[model samples]
Target: MRAKRTPVLDRACRACGFSDSRGLTHAKLQSGETVTLCGTHELMLRRAGGAVDAGELRGVLSDRRDTVRRSVGGGDELAESLQEAFAPNRRRTERRAS
Candidate 1:
């Protein structure tokens, strides 16, 4: 029995290492190999005579737009929390002079 191939959900872009899911897309090359790509690389592929699905490209672009919109709307709070989480340890370790 042939093993079923599972779709990769967390693949990094082939041309660039942009792993953000919001702007990532998959394309099947004429050589029958599937590749993950960021929006820029996908457009490059299309411009270089590669076939890209119009519907899929539109969906990816719309989703990316929505993500950007949400980020612009309320990303400050999340950014602050992340900053606090990754901030250097501030507790003093030296013994205080009595």
Candidate 2:
């Protein structure tokens, strides 16, 4: 009987900040392999035609919004600012879902 094969574990580069959960723009040290990056890094990679999975992008955006909200103490004014900054993107994402 043949044994089941285990999936290879993917790791992120701490120096370059790559991860499987995020999206990748450039090829990794190993040719033909893609590397995932955080939102901040993704934006930087955008110019290079880097793309992220919509769901992952949304999660990152939400986390960033939440971080901003918490940093501002989650007050009405802060929430309003965050909404102003992030609401448009949220709306766009929702519209794309339809």
Candidate 3:
């Protein structure tokens, strides 16, 4: 008989309990335990070579939030640029520019 396994996205982070489909990922530890971790914990585990504790989870989560906030603080420049390039009136100009 086989044990039932939890679905990947349905599992909570082993370190912090953060559960979002996009932010979750799986990692296999040296002990052969497969754990689902949020992006922050996964990064911490990879860098420090150990499981992140609950106390450390808070700091890591905050740092990750800040880093993501800073990186995405830029306005939607890509969307705007893409829209401008693909706008119907700009079709001829885009061809000429290319």
Query: What are the lDDT figures for the candidates, one per model?
Result: 0.66, 0.47, 0.66
lDDT, candidate 1, at 1: 100
Q: For each of the candidates, give the backbone clash count.
A: 0, 0, 0
Q: Of the candidates numbered 1 and 2, which has the greater lDDT value? A: 1
lDDT of 3 by residue, 1-98 (tens): 99998645437786667778688988766555566788877888778765445454345444453353554654588988998878898785556533
* Least accurate 10 contiguous residues by lDDT in model 2: 24-33
**lDDT, model 2:** 0.47
lDDT agreement of model 3 with the native: 0.66
TM-score of model number 1: 0.43
Write down the RMSD of all candidates, one decimal each.
11.8, 14.1, 9.5
Pairs in clash, predicted candidate 2 = none
Best candidate per TM-score, number?
Answer: 1
Per-residue lDDT over 1-98 for candidate 1, one digit per residue giving the tens place of the 0 to 100 score: 99998766447776657999889998776655677888887887776667455444344433343353534454577798887666666324444689
Query: Compared with the true structure, what per-residue lDDT tens digits does model 2 show for residues 43-98?
Result: 64454453344343334333333353435455588778887878776667556443
Worst 10 residues of 1 by lDDT: 57-66
TM-score of every prediction relative to native: 0.43, 0.23, 0.42
Query: Candidate 3, after superposition: displacement of residue 4 in Å?
Result: 12
